[model samples]
Target: MGMNYFHQLLCRSSRWERASATQIVPWALKGLDLGDNALEVGPGYGANVATLRTRVPALTGLEIDPALAARLRTRKFDQLRVIEGDATAMPLPDTEFSSVVSFTMLHHVPTPALQDDLFAEAFRVLRPGGVFAGSDGLDRPTFRLIHLGDTCVPVPPATMTARLTRAGFTDVEVHSAATYFRFRARRPA
Candidate 1:
């Protein structure tokens, strides 16, 4: 799926860059075990990859955009592996990652059903006791404007919590702000 002009601009914007560093990366890193490998979905321009690599040395990023994935590879982080793939139907093995992370990207999943598929995929790839953490935008006008023509299904905290639980994630927690939300869940040990 090719990105529209607005989506492309957002991916390369400084605002987005700053958010990845200041907001997303820190939130995603919380409660993660450094000894375990990690995977990040939709890591645009790989901003979070460097920060995440500091904690989890072996970090792989799954980006849906082939162009973005190729761009990420050029950075040459020895511990970072960039894979061009879909989040809903990831081309990855089950129980492979100790943690799975996504940052403000779930809303781009087209529909709530597809977003649930992403949750299921995350659960499928996580090892027992593995953590899945991420932040996403709420259904607000400001965030909707940012997405432009892209598919944006801003999920509410309660809905997200329920979906995570249904996806077999335990210890699910969803925190909501006025315009955004963060979540953390664990695959049962």
Candidate 2:
């Protein structure tokens, strides 16, 4: 199975386990303020939601695959609501959330237009002054060897900032380390 398929399998498992401390959602969420009524796109194995909801009381996840959404619903995470939908064309209303986030999913979105659409949707859903933060694997040999879901577009931090700017997000910032890229963007109040 592909890396994406493996992630789906992990979601189906009863107990969630991450591959590393770095990959754990709690560590990723540290020092970040994910506002209330948050939306997480492609939540992968629902691990991030498990941690994110601790900080944001009303957290929802939009997963493209219905099966994954079903599995997540069964998990019964207290602050989590799972919906089956695509990020590029989200099903929710505009300005509905205080925050929007994604984890390790942008690179797999296929085309640049789709990527922009995903960001646009994120922007549309977020209230002014809200934030978006995520960790994505960069397109590099080591990352490719381990995580085939790494972006085909090689989203450098600058490129992500530019994209966020075009999507009406301001104060975009990126922090790169090892094989991953972390970014935070804010909607203007």
Query: Which of the numbered candidates is closest to the native, going by highest lDDT?
Result: 1
Residue-wise lDDT of candidate 1 within 1-189, one digit each (tens)?
345688778777778777778877687556657456899999877767767877886899998977788888887456588888999999999999999998888877888889999999999999999999988878877777767777777777788778999999999888876676889999999
lDDT of 2: 0.75
lDDT of every model, 2 decimals = 0.83, 0.75
The runs of at least 3 residues in candidate 1 whose Cα sits more than 4 Å from the true structure, single-residue gaps closed, are 1-3, 76-79
Q: Against the true structure, what is each candidate's TM-score?
A: 0.91, 0.84
Note the residue pairs that clash in candidate 1: none
lDDT of 2 by residue, 56-95 (tens): 8888899886766787788755658888898999999988
Report model 2's TM-score to 2 decimal places.
0.84
List candidate 2 stretches off by more than 4 Å. Answer: 1-16, 19-30, 147-154
